[model samples]
Target: MNRSLVRHWIALLLLPLLAACGTTPSSQHYLLTAPEAPLPQGMTPSIGVGPITVPEYLNRDSLVKRIDSNSLAISSTERWAEPLEDGILRVVALNLAGLLQTENVRLYPWHPKRAPDYGVKLRLVEMDSNAERVVLVAEWFVYRVADDSTVARRLSKQSRPLPATTQNGNEVAAAYSELLYALSQEVAASIAEAQGNPAAVSAPST
Candidate 1:
């Protein structure tokens, strides 16, 4: 065959392969979201949520799962609708409001005069999942601006099983959101304890 004809044939053969390679799956976005629990009978919100942090690996738009003890699997097609940190902040704040039966919840940077009576700061250590379960470990503290001191502090770890009937990435993501809601319950309990007796707040180790 002539060289020009041979080159044309090669190009034609590669066309379909290139097209197939370029056919990427559509991305599926998921949110770590939770519904507000109903406000309690007479309580109102009086807390602010702020300064939540997550690990660098969990900071991405993609969801990650621990596939093995030492390995993780990152989902390409399943993505976060917002940064994971922001989602955590929102869920925790909303959950607290509902748990405490108040509408006084606010995010950071509220005017000092309008600031809630207490502030919540969260540091997320291990918020991850596998096919079987989702895990969350967080360090949280409640601060009282009037006294310029922390009134409550505790480390909380929680897990929720991925339902056997639930499907892959989507289900795992929902599990994570549920875990946050669970963790918020612990935080709220601690806050209440400290309120009745500030001395109950956990102190730093020696």
Candidate 2:
């Protein structure tokens, strides 16, 4: 091929490569955090948190924003450091351990010997963030593992205003963390109340 023709083809090939490189920005990955500090030591029951579920739309790695009641947008450059459900489960477990001040907390599917006294089952109905606020809706149950008897069941609908300083994915993640922390408080209280711990009966819920 002629030199000019070969150079023209090379330029055409490089054009797409350069354009692709310019359009694909580096993604920012964020993680959901648990409460900063554990609560005071107390006689909390052995608790299990999990078999938790989230919405199908939230199963992806990207962060989501609600455009309106019917519309949604998924970010290309903002993403979760891990799966959303995994993050939720991990943070809930940690928060419970902290709130209850006991080392007997376990995730779902523990060995028969290590089975917790109370099993916490949660299903997240909605988890979304927008310019104004973050919303989390969850249905949860606390049951006695030994007798397979239900202790507490509740559906929690919670919202927190997005930080006025910023409404990025990081801030949204922080809001999610706070919601999960509140949920842990309710779960811990249920377990404690069942175990006859007076202090936990008054623990707050979201």
Judged by TM-score, which candidate is best? 2
> Root-mean-square deviation of each candidate, in angstroms?
6.3, 3.0
TM-score of every candidate:
0.82, 0.89
| Residue range 1-206, candidate 1, lDDT tens digits | 89999999999999999999899788999877765455444443378888899988888998888978888888888889998878888888877776776667888867888867788999988988876788889998888756758877888898988887755777887788778877777777767776784232221112
For model 2, the local distance difference test gives: 0.85
**Model 2, span 103-163: residue lDDT tens:** 7788987889877888999999999898899999999999988888999999998889986
lDDT of 2 at 168: 89
Candidate 2 Cα outliers beyond 4 Å, as residue runs: 1-4, 39-44, 201-206
* TM-score of candidate 1 to 2 decimals: 0.82
By summed lDDT, the worst window of 10 consecutive residues in model 1 runs over: 197-206
